[model samples]
Target: MKRNIVILASAITALCSCNDGASDKAPVADSSEVKTAPENNKYTSQPLVTHIYTADPSAHVFNGRIYIYPSHDTATGTPENDNGDHFNMMDYHILSMDSVGGKITDHGVALNIKDIPWAGRQLWAPDAAFANDTYYLYFPVKDKKDVFHIGVATSKTPEGPFTAEKEPIKGSYSIDPCVFKDDNGSFYMYFGGIWGGQLQKWNNNKYDSAGKLHQPDELAVLPRVAKLSADMKSFAEPVKEIKILDSTGHLYKEKNNDQRFFEAAWMHKYNGKYYFSYSTGDTHNIVYAIGDSPYGPFTYKGLLLAPVEGWTNHHSIIEKDGKWYLFYHDVQLSGKTHLRNVKVAPLVYNADGSIQTVHSQK
Candidate 1:
């Protein structure tokens, strides 16, 4: 999804040294010193750390601790446009903690854009999976021809100096790769985003600079799903489009911006059901749908999160110590869209298994 270009002078926070998974002394800032975001509402959630800017957090529990994989935001002075030119992020830093709001460790740079041979620029959102005793990091980046491709990297530990493969995954395009592993030991990836994400340009399964756009009366662009091979490197089958239906079980039309998919696809299971959540980009909301199978014609449930103090919202949900937490990012630290900070808050589920609406604050 496209982000707004709002830049401001950054306020530095006090730095502290901590033990990282890589055994490197990574710098982290005192969370108390970070400024509250410019919002009218009070917030209980704060940035996990403020020493550096991070966004699009994909957090997972590994070895009884939480590991976060987020895009390392940097102010490259590039102007913003609908094409997402200003988000000049070139690397990834892994964050881990024993508990939420506890001492968090910055794992240093896990992967860099320069290290990937086929990558061009803008290493956007990424996700991690642990399978076959190996940690796999899945990410999306534009190649030399400026088309987006999803890639995978390998590491022995959750916090990593990952080694990238020589090329992107075959038959993969678009951005925001969320790899979800099932209880049966199968892995599935849910991804796709419009606008700068370039999903609209791939209507024919290939990129066309002058692609046709869906008419307002047509069903909106659908998020894609594919099963990961046993090796967890390539797709096991052809990528298929996912259908999102309204509460009445009807497909969402293109004009339904507030309900249609934009970007940041995430899947988490609870009580034998698959919950597919994503951002409604321009409307600034995180919504979800529920289905019996991971490959779903899911029926829309409702809003998981309302609008925050930023133009975009991306998130991940995980259960820790019998409690659920939502990890997300906002422009609270730098007051800029591209320079974002990660935050976590408790997520609640009603007795009926429906998620309670979350409203983020400053």
Candidate 2:
């Protein structure tokens, strides 16, 4: 649900502040100045989507174009609601970058809270993957009981009037649903947060409904995985506490914050190696480690992206044509930590197989 303190603090604040157990509704931006990024080869500092607040960027390439699924940020509409300072998102918008550089088109709301039968008000970060000739959107939302469950929405096309499944993917209770397909054509579901993370790989090319599940705040979690069934509505083959390494080459969690993954788990397979990248939970920085396999005893690498002022530093890495780009968000639009704007920068690799520190500003 967040990057750094303001968002994490806001989420923790929202989680703690909500007497009724929900994210606080945010206050609307008042004449916020939007920075127009300079057109240059160095970097594109400005947000790809402006005019409205967006957060939790989930970038995907479809039909030779880059399609981004971002959570909508809006005002709470009431002065008393967390002073209008919160994560208050209820829907998602599908924005597609028509070209590699500039020009982002708002395809409007792809899915709404009202359409989701089992979802609560705070619709958080969402991710989408294309498979079986269908676009499946993975979403996490707080239930009425204030517990978050991962759900999948389906659409015939990229910009969709998506139909959400009445039931969420069972056997897991975490946020930020990221789905990836390996070279072998098998699907893997990666999820979990804060206290730990999880990873699960698909078997026989389908999801199993009877796997184990855990809460987002579970202290024992560590990159567990589950099979994303072909139907995309269930999961199975739960692996528990797959070890992630700290800087000292020991199990993660044993150490403190330095080079430790706080939350926001993203997986990328490059050069026949698995790159497990995540946000450092103080919400200020992003770091990654590499392992020989997807669920691995990964060696702690280095920081991927430096901290942005606002809060969350969630990012996605994708390749287009022959170049790689990083999709992340910043609080530049409204200057308030929670009201974030999505930004993109060219991401490149070093000869040593490690990622370079992101210079997102021009």
Candidate 3:
């Protein structure tokens, strides 16, 4: 049976403050000083749709329309909520926006778990890109033990029943897959997560997984990058692990606290500068760094957004319209489980090109 599930974003004013240290002042910018742009180009707090339960949102302007591909969680499956519990959700769903102010029409599951042989019922973190009349969905899947690995699938239509490649894109355990097509038309895949293996300890390359000294393990939780072949079917070269952020020292020193390093990497090229935003501190907040190139010597740009106490902010970034809009997920107040509902707000930038702050709607 063909089903069209149109999930909508509802209006809820759950105010969450952006942390700027001990300041009690609100994070809102003065609207009087803010210059307005054209009606079609202006930023607003209104969401086109609501009531969604997807996370790790990756959007693109394709064929005069906006299409969003996110990790698909089966509404009727086990671990039916989004509280980090691993279950079989090996599908990519698509939402299409016809116009700037148009409603988001959920086109049902674009891909499904039955499509991938090695996938063990769980899917998470998906990103999509269009090339050569095909839309590519890059996502992560887990085996029975919940060990994750990255995979790719392709379809001719934006709203698709994508077909997974016969094999994974060449890596062991990993998740949160992101695909970047460079200006020169080169394709690259960035992904990593808590893969079980003897990899290097977080933050530094000193210790191994077993607390022994050795070279970095290819199956570490830390982020890694690899180039794809021209056809995007296989890895063109070897997987090169890149340490996004490590908290080995912090984790070792503060043994009582659960230390999280970097995961969930999304790369965007803006104004000749490459911005890499990633999740940190238990996927509760986001931090970013910029570099001159995609493969880089990156410099930390500080925190872009933080957790809202009652909510978590995972993989997100600004959608560059006339005014930038930050797209992220938050746990709705009404739900007990963390079903990562999508939310957006204006992203203001400082004179130095760093994100000044992201404001939430009241």
In terms of lDDT, the best-performing candidate is 1
* TM-score for candidate 2, residues paired by index: 0.79
TM-score result, candidate 3: 0.72
282-356 per-residue lDDT for model 3 (tens digits): 445677767787775456666776553233455545354465546665434223234444545545567777875
lDDT of 1 at 289: 95
> How many clashes (backbone N, Cα, C below 3 Å) per candidate?
0, 18, 12
Q: Estimate candidate 2's alpha-carbon lDDT, on a 0 to 1 scale.
A: 0.67
**In candidate 1, which residue pairs clash?**
none
- Residues 37-111 of candidate 2: C-alpha lDDT, one tens digit per residue: 333322235566555677778888899988988878776552333212266678887878644453567777799
**Using TM-score as the measure, what is the rank order of every candidate, best first?**
1, 2, 3
User: Which residue runs of candidate 3 sit more than 4 Å off their true CA positions?
Assistant: 1-52, 74-83, 86-90, 99-101, 144-146, 195-221, 243-260, 309-312, 318-321, 359-362
lDDT tens readout by residue for model 1, 15-107: 111211122244444222334344222443557766778899999999999999998888887899988988878989998988765578788
Worst 10 residues of 3 by lDDT: 1-10
lDDT of 1: 0.84
How many times do residue backbones clash in model 1?
0
Q: Which 10-residue window in model 1 sums to the lowest lDDT?
A: 4-13
Higher TM-score: candidate 1 or 2? 1
Which candidate, 2 or 3, would have the higher TM-score against the true structure? 2
Worst 10 residues of 2 by lDDT: 15-24
Instruction: Give all candidates' CA lDDT scores.
Output: 0.84, 0.67, 0.55
